[model samples]
Target chain A: MRDASEPGALPTPGGPRVRLLDADSAPLLVRDHFAGGDPGPIVASLAQVPELVGPTLPFLGAVLGPSWIPLREKEIVILRTSAVMGCRYCTDTHTVVALDSGLGRDEVRALRGDLPVAGAFSDAYERALISWCDAVAFGIESDIRPARAALDADDARVVELTLLVATTVMLNRYATALGLPVSVDARARLAEEAL
Target chain B: MTALATALADESLGGRVWFYTNYHCNLTCSYCLTESGPKVARRELDRATVLDLAREAKDLGFSQIGITGGEPFLVTDLPELLAELAGVLPVLVLTNGTLFQRALLDRIAPLGDADVSLQISLDHPDPVANDVMRGPENFRKVVEAVPALLALGIAVRIATTLEDGDADDLPRLCILHRSLGVGDEDHVVRPILRRGRAETGDMGVRARYLDLPPELTITADGAFWSPFAPTVRGGSLDTDLLLSRTVRPLQRPVDAMITVLSGRPEGADSTLNIR
Candidate 1:
């Protein structure tokens, strides 16, 4: 299991203090940044939870590897989707990875809702994806009829991809609610590599 | 914009158009709505078909057109598509910032000359939270991408989804945005849409506050307005969907909110209402 403070971990500024779960009886740190109230129950519940990182990380790695989707495209969707969901922590992390994946500065800016279509994406495809993101993030009921019909063999993969993206959004909310801070050193390392 | 405005206000009479390119993406987040992947089928809309749809949208008087799927950038000829659409009406594209290249940037740079805007998603204000949502290293990637786009002279806006209990975090996010060079005037903060995996998650402290009505009336353009204000333009559709079988004359702001919140039947009841 990964401890709260690893060798290269960077302390989150103004973020929550993370206490690694060592034993079953260890007290959990439940208070989160987004959740306004008590953190006792939340932290206790998560504390000492076994095998917390493996399943999620490996599953995500397998599903998002080169065989599943291009590294660049996957990163772009993840970064933008996280942004839309208001998961700032996720957005910051994904943005760095996106740059490392070969996306340029202009492309990153566009992900923040700049030009109607991103430079690398098709206009029609961009419209469909953005609308879907908005619909899901905003809780708006969307008629995906156009998106469905527009999908061809090449685009059918989106169905699975959408589930992955949605899952990440869920995780972001959960993590933030629990008051987990960004692994500072890791984020910095990524930024350095990407640049 | 008028067509979008009209459709958002009235759900019954317009046509909906969707364009899918591919499912390939650069990041691997825990929750993805499309379940996108690289090996999956590559069903995509060709250039000619997209052009045809644009013409159809104009003919139908359907004011809204949406494009989506995995990462649309995996397609090779995106610049051409944008150039063609530039001649048509308004178009909006949703994207993650990973696939953007300088060549493509040059090709689509002209879109600003036409009426086109891009809506990017940034879930959290903090770098760690944002990266955790996508995958390791994604936070830095998106951060770097922002300044690059700004350098191109593109107008960028940040959209943050405010989950229940996340309201207070807005100021924190705003501060983060400012640090990244995003002005308060240019960013957009929104509430989280409780659907998909979100419905199954913690419901948070605010979840109990969401008072869901029944039935929602969404216009063709995708706006959920109040159904009680004599018009369904900005009203909630939940109240209308559950209370009335027909499109009731929107009369009050409160009534419209009831309708809009309840418009999407699935998971609406589970949403955390935090005022």
Candidate 2:
């Protein structure tokens, strides 16, 4: 991720992709995340990395963000893998996002792997979906890649899942290397701002 | 299994997170870590965001919370923030104790019931001696505030940076701090680790992280895994220290924490760990 290729020149003003913002302008990334909405708690956190405003950031934002991966599937993979990997920062940061994704409170709790996945999600089909999520979380997908047959996830969906896993590592590393914490009610506050 | 291997195999990592509520401080200690000074712009977290972060941290299993700033008391909504966080996790406020007005004290005194304590700096005993490193009259205000805080039934401890002032005189200073009701055990006397504005080794010897534990830090902007190297906006130090977008539904810092905290050389896997 460190091409540092002279950091390809930033786009022009009102360009399609925003440039790497200087520290003074770092707050602009919030609008990038929210589509010109009010800023969120992430603004306070992400503004520190002015480099993210560069040519690659808008692309990286699209790849790692909520655009391609279905929020449900992506959050399940992100939360499950992060929890299983012992990444408190990721798990904490994503729990509310999972809740906001329409997962039940108990379903969210069950996804942590500390509780039985079946107890919270009663439907056998739902359990199978969760089992698939567990396999993705375990990175044991080759054994279960055949099982992708049972769900509505298409071939393109598998690619999205792979992309999500690859990006989760990057996301987790950002928190670990930089020591980012889960802001309280971050998802709710951000949701409130959107409202 | 080794501690790291076992920890790596585990399912969760709990870190105490420090929220830098604002970058405003009353005095500019020569060795201040956050570059906090009178002129530092106010970048405080709102009460909703602070409480939200606290709740999320509790679910993530954080055991402690630290409210720090140019000076935490400089934020008008601090008492309300303290009351909310004190209810969820044991909290410590790393303050200069230079701004403890009774009205502010009344609002936060109930924090004692919530496991909140003050880790106010008292680098030296005599005002003249302490003021040499910190600005003028620092020792007087902190010393005066310490006893009053203790009298309010709020737990108080003296925090000192060894690199900024006299370490040899610590025995004397600790005793003077004890006179203000800070128990001998309550003293947090340590060397100033080179960070933020003090990287030139102008403060003390560089105290690089021998190893990073699973610690979380949320500044006015985003979250991080370590607090040793903070991004000072346009400053010279490497400031690629953010982990997630507060507005999104993804995460990445904990795995990186496990790899580094496991005693592997940093950047062992990727350029993420380059010093």
Candidate 3:
């Protein structure tokens, strides 16, 4: 079994420090690394290193809001992209959120193509979104071009933000590949809950 | 089968239905299947039309209904619409978590009484990574909204997208979920859809199949489906009923129904036994 306390532990030049939190049930030793002294400088220095698989919630909020895209489409794109990328972490995490967003077992299942396309997404717009997701996943940029072309001036800005949202899948895949531990809260939730 | 046959069979069994409120979405993901958002509105389903459809679905025996869109929250009267639907059938609203407002929550919170659930999507557990994917600021917004939903005593779940090497990264994602205040008791993990960008080249479909259990079903859209046919077009009356029957029987004592529903054929040992 893996050591839960040292989930993503790394040995630095000075000593050992926990890098990522493990999902397993184990007590986290927060003060162990800083016990020797105040490691403010070290912590600050670590912050300089860009996180490969970081979070995107803040960015999403600022760019997209009430007037443009709804939460459902945003999440559907995220989850669909993650699914296309084949990132389990992204898939699992988004599945929970998708549920909270009001997708039930059937709709969630339908998201994976369980239901017929004719009945799955009720509108052409949604079908277009799903198609665009496929184009990006398959490296078919041209597919999204039409959708981009169809946008009006204001909606076009939202489309730009959508591109950024799509990019997250790339980062998510990279982070998962590198073996960074999930955050503490995510681990606890997965352990006790279904996600 | 023809579309009509599919619809008839679908209607006979009374399965779940989805309503896309609009083609607009807040984010533009690279691998989106529908090319949703920005400039696509050929068929926008307004709340009234959706309610009419919902009533039809209920009459047809559908127990669950989903409200989807570029962002359902973007619809001005979404909470009211959800409220209306709650009176008839259980409703699930899919969202990105950026548009969850207090007023909406206040209106919809009471509707969770055995007939409603909210699903939020947060791609990456790490702030930087999530922000980078969703834009430069989404990470904070989603994180902030999570606590708000939880505070309402509303059930919240996080949906993370899975890519080729995500299984190895599961540990980190779990940690991230907890850090974001989502507990294991509160969420479920789901696989990413494979029909999009991930399908380009030989995106390692074999690797994705490795972690999945035997008998796991994968959708044509590339999501891990449980007990159902591989494609939505492949669904039939018999298939739907079979899925409903086999799902519960196939689940392990500790397995979640949703997990089973999201099962895929990737990564399963051929010889392993499934209930």
Q: What is the TM-score of each candidate against the true structure?
A: 0.40, 0.55, 0.40
Identify the candidate with maximal DockQ. 2
Q: Model 3: per-residue lDDT, tens digit, B1-275?
A: 63323433543222455565654566755434334455544235567766765676566445667666556777777778887887878877777788666776677676656466777777676778666545566677788887887777666677666555656766787787787678777555554443223333223232222233312221112112222222111111111111221121222111222233234233334231210
List where candidate 1 sits over 4 angstroms from the true fold: A1-195, B1-18, B101-103, B162-165, B178-186, B191-275
* CAPRI-style docking class of model 2 based on DockQ: incorrect
lDDT of 2 by residue, B41-140 (tens): 7777777877877787666455678877778888888887888888888888888888887777788777757788888888777678789878887888
For every candidate, how close is chain A to the native chain A in TM-score? 0.64, 0.60, 0.56
Off by over 4 Å in 2: A1-195, B1-14, B209-214, B231-241, B245-275
DockQ of 1: 0.01
Q: Candidate 3 on A73-160: residue-level lDDT in tens?
A: 7666766677667665565556667767766555555555545544766777666676666666666667768755553436674565
Score residue A189 of candidate 3 by CA lDDT.
53
Q: What DockQ values do the models have?
A: 0.01, 0.03, 0.01
Where in model 3 is the C-alpha error above 4 Å? A1-195, B1-14, B101-114, B179-181, B196-275
Query: Regarding DockQ, does 1 or 2 come out ahead?
Result: 2
Model 1: per-residue Cα lDDT over B1-275, one tens digit each: 44333434554222433454444566544444333455544556577766765665555454544455556667778766765765666655656665556766776677656555554567676777776666666656667766666666555566665655667678888887677778988677655433223323432222211232212222222212211101111111111112221221322212333333334345444232311
Every model: iRMSD: 21.7, 9.7, 20.6
Give the Å shift of residue A75 in candidate 2.
36
